[model samples]
Target: MTDWRSDLELITDAARQAGAVAMQHFRQSPEVWWKNEGRSPVSAADYAANAVLETVLRSARPEYGWLSEETEDTSCRLERETLFVIDPIDGTRAFIAGLDTWCVSVAVVHLGKPVAGVLVAPSLDEEFSASEAGEATRNGVPIRVSRHIAGDHLRLAVAEDLLNRLDPLFVRDVERIKHVPSLAYRLAMIADGRIDGTLVKRNAHDWDLAAADLILERAGGSLVDLAGERLVYNRAKVSHDELCAATNADLPRLLRHLGLGLQG
Candidate 1:
């Protein structure tokens, strides 16, 4: 059997290499286009990175199944026990706009759960990774979720819609809210202790949140749906809705505020 650790190392390396390819194209003025009714943007950089990532990963593990945002999906993955789930470039809007918040997100899913994950944000000089049996780390240092209490003093991470829809109680207590275009990076921020928590009502795709979920969970954090349910992966439809991610601080209150109960 192939060593999962070594396989993960290869995946991590591939992700970084792909990130470099993206940065190179990102330096130049690349064509950016819209997809799915302008809900998401795709750039030349995205395809460039996807090509590199797919080539490297497939060569490294020829037997493993493949799933990626920029690649065509196939039913062959259903028969494979292990698969690679990836977003060649998350936050394409940020990338196309010459912003530095995008990243290459990759996850190793075994039996429908992520066993390893890596999120490389080259521009931010940050790489967050986690293994099921190992520690979660940013760069080389260990990281974890914050245990801070949420109140009038706590900061939050959210999209603009949620900010507008939140109850006055939540709005009043949240000391600050930072908008991050990439959901994966936002969850990674929670894992790296950069933010308190993030809430979203939209169903996030498995590829969008898988890597960050493992990173955060291993860092003593949590990624739950509005029902306070753990995020699941390898679904037929790669999208998810109504998810929240945070360090275990004040989670109960946040769920209550959202009128949700803990899920099994």
Candidate 2:
């Protein structure tokens, strides 16, 4: 098998390069277009960053298949044992709005699991990376999830709708973090101990979670469905259902409070 550590290095570098490309168009009012039936926005920076990531990562790992949000999907990836899954510029809306919460996310998935991943937020000067064989890191320093227990006033980056669904008593003790436009960054926050947990709504695609999922896992956290099953990637259907992310120490309580069964 290929060295997952090396794959992590490869994506970390590629993400950095792609992030730099995106920065050129950030806050510059780069041209924008709509996709997903006009529900989503795509900017020139997204495509430019995608181009850089495609060229750099693919050239270095031609044998690996490719799947990028900016690129059209293809069945060719299904034939390979390993592939690169990318979101050239995650949180395009935030980036276009001149916010610094967006990031360039990239990951290497092998046999339906992420072995390596990187998320670079250029505007924030933050770079998160992890491999199956290594601990999660931000800017080269090892990081882990927060160890806050359930009774504590846990900090959560969650959607308003989801927050309202929880028991009021449970909600009372929780501190709701302001909305973070980037789902990827929000999850990364949990990995680096910035928050206690978050609830992810349905319809999130692989590109949005794959890289950060691995990073969160390496940092002693998990991203799982309501049933507490961990996520799988690179499948025919890339989109995921509602999910929850938190450090292992707090995940069970979060799920319990949400009325979900314990994670297996």
TM-score each candidate: 0.92, 0.95
Looking at model 2, which ten-residue stretch has the lowest summed lDDT? 255-264
Give the alpha carbon lDDT tens digit for every residue of 109-190 in model 1.
8888888899999999989998888789999799987766533355678666556566776677775566788888988888
What C-alpha lDDT values do all the predictions have? 0.82, 0.91
Off by over 4 Å in 2: 149-151, 259-264
* Model 2 C-alpha lDDT versus the unseen true structure: 0.91
Residue 256 in candidate 2, Cα distance off native in Å? 2.8
